[model samples]
Target: MPFYIRARTYFKYAEEQMSLAEKEKDPEKILKFTLEAAERAVRALWAIVQVEAPKEKPPLEKILAEIDKACEPDLAEEIKNHVRRIKELAQNPSVEAAKEALILSRQVVRRTREVLEPIIGPAKRVDQHRRFYF
Candidate 1:
């Protein structure tokens, strides 16, 4: 398929995952959707870079560096902490804690999108115009 179509599809999947995470009564599903959202976003970004920058693509470290650069230091640290917690949750998600995880995942998704906007460009952002009220 075409690059733009693929990007849109990935974004849609990410949003679906986000929605599922919010409605998740099962702890495992909550953790799964959190990861699914992050993974889809990262994969979409990488695909965009691969298509747009091809032969001169930026390294993964550089892409992550750019994301980190855009975020506030404290916010970046908090994102990291959440990532670590998500990994732990993947091993075991309790229904009570999973609700909290869903909230944290949404925050991460919002911040991550902000950090990635420059890399993904205006087209993707245009699709995300509707905000998810927390």
Candidate 2:
């Protein structure tokens, strides 16, 4: 998919996952949704550079590859770092980890918007509420 459609698709999924995560009472379920949100946000970033995310372990590498694929300058390293946390959250699910994942996922989506919107058209404003943790 191209930037306009790809970014919008994944970004919307990310927001929805975050919403579910916030409402979850079980720590594992919270982590599950938070990880999905983060993964979808990273997918949106990949869309920005017109790169497909690698389907495998090491989500950080999956996200970071987009930086080189398009040779896009000014790719934020922090997004990759956040991906690391997201991957770790998968291994060790907890309320705190889910909260961190939620925050990091939002950052990835926000940063992706900064780049994606200008190239593909405007990104719709998604809700920016912080997910309340258990």
lDDT of each: 0.63, 0.69
lDDT of 1 by residue, 1-134 (tens): 55555555666676779888878677888888987776565445445434453456454345444444435777656766765676667777688667666777777677656655654455455768865878
Which TM-score value belongs to model 2? Answer: 0.68
lDDT of 2 by residue, 27-78 (tens): 7888788778777777766665664543453454655765555324545566
Q: Best candidate, TM-score-wise?
A: 2
In candidate 1, the residue pairs with backbone N, CA or C atoms under 3 Å apart (3 or more residues apart, or in different chains) clash, namely none
- Report lDDT (Cα) of residue 96, candidate 1: 62
Q: Ten consecutive residues with minimal summed lDDT in candidate 1? A: 59-68
Worst 10 residues of 2 by lDDT: 123-132
Off by over 4 Å in 1: 1-7, 52-80, 115-134
